[model samples]
Target: MKILQSKYTNSFFVLLTVTGLLSSCYKPKKHFLQASGNYVLALRTQGTNSTTDYLLSMDTINTASKNISATGNGIEQLAWCYFGSTGSTVFSFSYGTNNVGIGYGVREGGGLYEKGRFSFERMDCFGKGDDNTLVAIGAPWGGGSYDCQIQLIDATTMSIKKKKLTPLYMRDGSDKLNKWPTSIVVNDNKMYVSFYPLDGGSWNTDLTDTAYVTIYSYPAMDSLTTIKDTRTGPIGYYGNQVNMIKSENGDIYTLSPSSLAAGYTQVTRKSGILRIKNGQQSFDPSYFFDVETASGGAKVLSATYAGNGLLVARLQIPGSDDISKLWAAFDVTIPICKIAIIDLNNKTVTDVTDIPVHGGQYGAQGLVEDGKVYLSVTSTIAGEARIYAIDPLTATATKAAKIEGLEVPAIYKIVN
Candidate 1:
């Protein structure tokens, strides 16, 4: 094991200067000490095989950690799923495939181990069940052209408990093609599934700005209604989790990137946040925070809610809409992202000072826990991959950990 220590600077002056300039003054939160727990970081190493390693560290600031490599098993692409209640078990899904893997036993001496491996047709997003079950949503590859499938898996035994499918169609009752599930959330015995209804499996500028979410009765998997909203493009993006989050009060909020590649034109709707009130299937008509407008023309790529109505977000500045630029932005090959903290209650956004504006591939890269928000800054522009611990209240960010020679794409905190 190697310890890659990051250089801590006396950069508090920068935050202090910025804090004084903002209308709503920033307040600092309590600092967290380096403690022993299960912390996972995903590194995407370049090679013909596209190898990815899930490194588990017992203590976040310590040098001791174990690596679980996914070199084979046809898992060239992967996405992290939600952590279980115990935080000892975590899940991940492979891109464009039916494969799902579970990593558990983080507290055991052997480090994190693969407890089970299973398959569904194809899944883009996942939700947690009240009875320790995992709900997966997506469509079958090369099949289910006009239908989306949902499956419930027993997380403890890794077995399929039930399955169902629903046909997708336009408002006029015409069959919708190339429509697939992007994200899902389970709340109060009901499941909400967000979908991207593409023109023909690809982006078209002429596509409507409206996105739809279908609500269903959980466990029974019966479709109740499909709701649409034109305020945002979609509830979530592909290849990322954590876009849709539920508050402690049972209200649900989701982000829409509305990226250029997603077929959102300048004249169309911009990226923002939308809320679904508790016990309501439709979006809150009066609630909306236009992130793009707040960022002075930048688009929101991803966001995660910090407790107390604060949301840490990654904003993409306006840039060329060329395909290559879009690919580079998605691959984190360029520094094009700005980290901002959004105040949901006040409807304000403030940029975090002292942190590098760099590129990160996934929107789920930010994790909030124990009064701290951990962000993975994975760009070669900084010369090394590092994680920053943000004090959301004070709006101050400090370099917490570093990964010496790997392009870390995501980080997860697991406690036993």
Candidate 2:
């Protein structure tokens, strides 16, 4: 589609800090982890006007003696971005100001470098397509349009491969409103993009009693069908969190966080999980996991699939969802977020008691290695920013690496 190129290609924002080492060193996260790869962390700290992000490639993250700081240590992104990875490339989709996506890669053995970048119209949410494609959906705002611009990026060359202006299909077969996309999941040769009907002008989610996912053929990018399930409010929430995940057996599971904590004015249906069996285009009628009830009425904040029918989730503290404090769900000081393990198969929520309660998490993509997912845990009580290695099955967590900044929103292990 000939995506536009950024004019400021090699611009690097210099970051400085005067504080000394803020943490003590420990040991590697896992001894059995492979030694031939590098770990990349996108560290986000505050700037004058917006947040500043830096991609730091390091060897170890668990030791208190080792404090990793974004200061003069990594690739500084243009601005705050929504991140997602496919294959070896990590994409930083610029949000708020710039409409460009820049990709970073691991050096021969250690360090980070920019692979390429391309500008686009707008990409509100992101998904991984196969091993070489990064999919983005540019949804309209404020009752302006019904067309969602879908674009695919070739990770190899870091260019927009193709784009299509696909229109939304409402229940009445009339496009009077716009559907905002939450996430995209491509599996089994089909692309699944989940959305919720929204009145842009009113900014209220009127159709919040059903889940919607549109299926399209892969590579060919053909819209095959639109599927809806009334068991949940919608297949996703706001702030670009991943709402769907594909398991090992190729079954796609979608999470509907119909919670007011995530900016939903009214949550009609219960927050839940729905699945699409392998090689199928429709939701599995027999499966529906009531996550809201499982979490004891607390609103789900974020979730990342951790294989084997388990998901590492963050839930708000019961009775802490105060919409009056705008975006309080993510305001780390609120002390309302709890880390738990969700079993999709048995429909259970196991609370991990080792970690302290915090505000909320910003990253949607969790870094999983050696059967444990690495999460950036920041607790006001703990008094430090650290990476907690959580075992989904056991529902336990161990403080691994210490981060000197705010939080490591995105992490990736690049085996170059």
Candidate 3:
């Protein structure tokens, strides 16, 4: 009887402990996903189609420690989104699956706060209208309609201030094609958008001979003139990238990557760079940088303005000779690109030797701090994702903090 009583008592205690532990887990407690720091970086894991991304904030990203994993860290995003920053705020704009844009701000008290979120029908490309506004362009991926949507989000209110549905430039009635926007740049009182013409149904870029840029009056959505340059095939690719950058003096420089790997159906023209002198509506007549010839036929995938009329660009290695792989460029799992510093003034390409060959990323904004350019790369050769600081003048690279993920989608500094 004593043994039976002891066994019952022991079982009852075990049950009580289990219930207490479970209750503690279910206790009402506030769960906050705030990180401590002044800088934010988007660490993306897995592939792009169905991706899992995390926005982690840290005090510094230059520590040469072991790989910094994004697992079990920071705020998990609502959906797959690309980043667009204005001032001290970072926005996660919806990609393919969802239609929402979430904003996060670096708090003065050392943690991040969910600033706000906005929704729209679609937002494919982004442009910084100013310090307070973000311009988003929404083009259809596949549909019977050709109408595009544009929205301007005010950072102060975290809501879209204005929206318009109109075509940047109307296509000829006889041409059954669609203009797909790759990048948007707002300079002064004008807005410039780069696009490629493709068959809406088949996605065939048949007009592979000239690059196009449409101009619109700033803050006013109206049909403006479309500028065409025949030196390159097109200005950009499928996903919005930093293809066009405005220099300090207001000159708008555009990168045209007529490479099959960059979603071009065929490469009939040389990849190059063109400029629209500040406040002008046409490409400069005498300035043309043939990037394909300069880099021995390698096509540039993305170019970020590094300062002093220099662009830190990522060019495809062996430059996409294979036209068979339709979506080869977006498949970043394969390492097929390398970083190079391009002199916009001298038309020279210098390769960064220290950084290993890496893959392509959509909308890669190389963060410039002081004189060095910091870019996120997934070095499949090194078997890790990390940040590399490259000196534009010397064409050298140095490794920084390691990333424990597929890629660091963006590196940002937001001071409170």
Q: Highest TM-score: which candidate?
A: 3
TM-scores of the candidates in the order shown: 0.79, 0.87, 0.89
lDDT of 1 by residue, 1-416 (tens): 22222122112111122112211221231222222456655545443422333444434532213222333211222332322322355665543222445544454432455567676556555666654677776653333366667878776776677888776435556645556566677898898887765544333334548757888998898989988889877656555446777788888887777775333332356778888998899999999988878778776666667888887777776663334343334445567777888787887878887577776464346667778787766656667566677777887887766655345555666655
**Judged by TM-score relative to the true structure, which candidate is superior, 2 or 3?**
3
Model 3 lowest lDDT segment of ten: 1-10
- Candidate 3 stretches with Cα past 4 Å from truth are 1-33, 47-50, 95-98
The residue-level lDDT of candidate 2 at 323 comes to: 47
Runs in model 1 deviating more than 4 A are 1-37, 61-87, 95-100, 108-110, 140-144, 203-205, 261-267, 319-324, 327-329, 404-406
What digit string (tens of lDDT, one per residue) describes model 3 on residues 22-74?
12222122324555667688876664323456787776776668455555457
lDDT computed for candidate 3 = 0.76
- What pairs collide in candidate 3? none
Highest lDDT against the true fold, candidate: 3
Report per-prediction Cα RMSD to one decimal.
12.0, 8.6, 12.4
Provide the lowest-lDDT 10-residue window in model 2: 11-20
